[model samples]
Each structure stands twice: as structure tokens, then as C-alpha cells.
Target: MSDIEIRPARFESPEVQKVVAEALADLSQRYGGSGDDTPVTMSDFDPPDGAFFVAVRDGTLVGSGGWRRHGSDAELKRMFTTPAARGLGVARRMLATIEESARVAGCGRMILETGYLQPEAIALYESAGYRRIADFGHYAGEDGVRSYARDL
Candidate 1:
């Protein structure tokens, strides 16, 4: 949409928290994730570090994605697109945007952990050149999350 804008979400910003919570709530509903965990949780990309972003269309946000460097590799977190905004290339654009950020930040590679329940998410990553990789970060311990990676 012409009004759609992709911008960084200030880590502690209220709007960022709202959108992220809504998105995670959606994911939790779809999968069995209780999502009781706070949506505003931290990572390498929060506030003093890391990055977050959102895609707003016609005043309503439709998608978001963010990444943070871990050693030399960038770890992507909080990537989500609302169903109402899917099939319009939103996810692909967000992925490219964040990957661009990674490249610009001097990262050599990028990695992410998605889930089996999210076929669309996995497909989007694969389409954007991310290949299946070992589970990473928060997903490292959980048996649920499936991870993927790609060179910048």
C-alpha cells in the first residue's frame, strides 16, 4: 500500500510493545505457545543494542522483523506479518530490510529460528535464501523452534 512504511521500533516504545504483543498473541493462538511470556522481552537488539522494525500500511501496522548481532552472525527476532497483510509481499520486504541492516552493520551471516507450526514463515525465509540450520538462541533449548541461516 502507498501508506506502508517500514521503520525501526524503539525497543521500549509503547507502540512497539503493543504491536509485538498482538503479533505474538496471534502466533501463540495458532501454535500451542501460551505466550504468557512478555512480548517486550529483551535480546541482543533491544534498546542499548539490537534493532526492531515494523511495517505500517494505511495507518495500521501489518508486519514487523528485527535482528541483532551475535558474534559475527546476526540473529533475527520478532519477525511477524498479520494474516490480513499476507500474500502481498510484506514478509519478503521486511526480511530484505532486516538483512540489509545486517549487511550494513558488517555482519557476515544471518540466522533465525522459526517453528514447524509456521509453514508460511519458514517458506518466506527459504524464499529469501535462508537455509535450514541448527536451532539457535532462545530456541537452542526448546525442542519446538526450528532454525535457519544464510550468509550475508
Candidate 2:
């Protein structure tokens, strides 16, 4: 935990972009093509309050997530964790970081879109005060995946 450094990542960094691309590639294969025709790039996801972040340990970025303001809501997106980082509370920490960002941005509620293919993600969200919510923002009904939201 002490080695973990959660900080903003730029879409310009090839390393960061590579991690994100790989995750999206997996998503693309899982959901019958890429999730978005014009996927949100890392640059499109960077942070002051609303931005993308990577949780680094030593020197490796092990986890990533982003929060974007969607009108009155802050939508969490692109949350991913490296396999090596699994079982280490990285996802929970990343979610907490995202929630902090949303709170700091003055957003009252946070929502997310996830897939059934990711059972671990479902459990994580459910345990973190999120509940089944109608698809919110752009990812609603695009597929039959589970969507959720939590009030901050």
C-alpha cells in the first residue's frame, strides 16, 4: 500500500495508452466490437478533478480509472487493473480514488457501466455502496451489461 501512487495519467504517454488500449481491446472482443466507435482516449480522460488516473506501485501503473462530468452526474469509466495487481485491494483503492475525485469536483452522484463478463467488478461495486441502477449517461442500453450508481 505504501508503494502505491495514484496519480493522473496522460493519453499521450504511450505506456499509459498501451494499458488502456489493451483493456479496451479486451472489451471490444467481449462485447461484439469496441465499446465506442470513437472511444474516449486517455487524453480525453485526464484529471484535476475529472480525469483518468493510474495507481502505480514501485514504477508500474497497476490500476486505472476515470471520472467524467456528465451533466449533474460524474460517470466512472475505463476502470482496469493489471493481473499482477489483483487480490491486492487495488480495484477498491482505485474506486475510492475515483469517488474522491467526484466528491472534490462537487458531483453528488456517481454512476458506471460495466459488463456481466466482469463478475469481480460487479461484486466490487456492490460492496462499495453502489446498487443496480438503470443505465445512465452514454452507456445505457447499449448492451445488456449491468450498470450501477452510488450517491456520494
Candidate 3:
């Protein structure tokens, strides 16, 4: 594999949006339903309060994820790695970056919501020290939605 670089990026950039769309589409199919597409926006990830990140390898966007303030914690959102880059540690790198950035911003913890259909994601978070937590935001009480949190 080529050198993979992860960096803060605008969520609205065309490349990011394209990957987001692809990720959601795959998730929707995996979950047996379509997604509503009504979540956070670019401004929600506009630094200090939040941030978005993308992983690029040899000029191709291979992974993406971001974090936003939710009450006193940083909420991870939009995490995804293209199928072609799934086992290259891209998602794990993006996750670590988000956590480090949140810590710098004084966030004591990081939280995220992923569906039961995404066992790989759950495994990644668990291996990284995240533990089960009560759901928050739109995921609260939503069947099949799994929530996890980790102290930063």
C-alpha cells in the first residue's frame, strides 16, 4: 500500500461528499433500508467546536470521519473506509486523530453511534477501548443502533 495521510478537511468538499454518499449507500444496503440523510452539516465540523477528516493515499480519498460537540462530549460521526482500503488501518487512524483532536479541545470523552449491522466498526471501537454507552441524539432508543464512548 502507498503512504496514507489523514488530515482535517471540510465535510462539504466534493470528494468528501462523494465518499460519504458511497459509505451511506453501502450501510443502507447492509441494514436492509435506506438512510434519511438528515444528520450533521459542514458547519457542525468547523474546528474548535468540531472537525472533519479525510484519509488520502496517492491522491485518492480512502477514508473519512469527524467529530462534533454534543453537550460536554465530542460525538464521532460519518466514519467510513472505502472497501478497497478496509484493512489498511485507515479507519483506525482516522478514529485516533478524532480522539486526539477532541482532547486538545478540552473534551473529556468521545462518543459514537453505529448500527448493529456494522460489526467491524463495533470491533474497532471496542479494541480501541470504547465501552457500551446509552444511546444519544437520534440514535436514542432506535432499534439496532449501538452507542459507545471512551474517555479521552
Candidate 4:
């Protein structure tokens, strides 16, 4: 298999938006909302506090993920792999990029919110050493939402 390459990306860039839109569309089908109601903006992924990234393999955008500072933790966001790229380690590579960037930026831990509907994502996180944590941020107290965290 060709290596997956990950690179920094502007959240507002069309390429990033295209992948993000695909992720949101997939989430919408499973979770019922478009995820547009959240406060995640381009500015949230700006330098010093956050970073966004895209993953490509064999010239195709395969996955995307990012980390935004939330107190002492880096909150993971937009983590998704294209349907065609699933099980190819695209998401795992993107996640490693996010975690390394977050650690470099002084974050001590990584956190994320996923839903019960996304068993694959939950399994991935669990396999990566993430453990259940209390609901956080916009997911706090929201039914069906689950949070996970791990030391970086």
C-alpha cells in the first residue's frame, strides 16, 4: 500500500472544506444533525492554539483531523476517513499527526467526542489507548454522545 501523507491545511481552504463536508455528511446520516450548529470555525484551528490537517494517499484525499486547544487538553475534531479509505489506516495516520502536533504545542492530553453510532471510531480510539471520559464541551450531557481522552 502507498504511504499516507499528512499535511497542515487551512480550515477555510476548499480542499479542507470538501473533506470536512464529507465527514459531516456521514455524521449527519448516523447522528441526525449536520454538526453545523457547533462553534467550530476556521479560527478555532489557528496557530498556537490549534492545527488542522489533511491526509492523502496515492494523490487522493483520504482523511482529515485536527486538534484545538481546550485548557490543558487538545480536543480532536473532524476526524474521518473516506468510505473507500476505511480500514486502510488513513484515520489512524491523521490522528497520529493531530496528537503529535498537539503534544508539540504543549498539550498534555488529547480528548474527543464521538457518538454511540460510530462504533468504528470508538473502537479505533480504544485501540489507540483512549479511555472513556466525562462528556465535554458541546457534547456535555448530550444523550448518545461519548467522550474519550488519553495522555499525549
Task: State the lDDT of candidate 4 residue by residue for 1-152, as single tens digits.
Answer: 35878899898898889999999999888877785356797888998999999888888788898989999999999998999888888888888889999999999999999989999999999999999998988868988988999999
The positional error of residue 113 in candidate 3, measured at the CA in angstroms, is: 0.6
Error (Å) of candidate 2 at residue 62 is 1.1
Error of 2 at 107 (Å): 0.5
The per-residue C-alpha lDDT of model 3 at residue 40 equals 71
Runs of candidate 3 exceeding 4 Å displacement: 36-38
What lDDT would each prediction earn against the true structure?
0.77, 0.79, 0.89, 0.89
Candidate 1: tens digits of C-alpha lDDT, residues 31-145: 7566534233555576434678899998877888888767888878778888798888888888888888888888889888777778888888888888988776655767677
Ranking by TM-score: 4, 3, 2, 1
TM-score of 3: 0.94
Between candidates 1 and 4, the one scoring higher on TM-score is 4
- Number of residue pairs clashing in candidate 2, backbone atoms closer than 3 angstroms, sequence gap of 3 or more or interchain: 2
RMSD of each: 2.5, 2.1, 1.4, 1.2
lDDT of predicted model 3: 0.89
For candidate 3, which ten residues in a row score worst on lDDT?
Answer: 32-41
Worst 10 residues of 2 by lDDT: 35-44
TM-score of 2: 0.87
Residue 16 in candidate 4 has what lDDT? Answer: 88
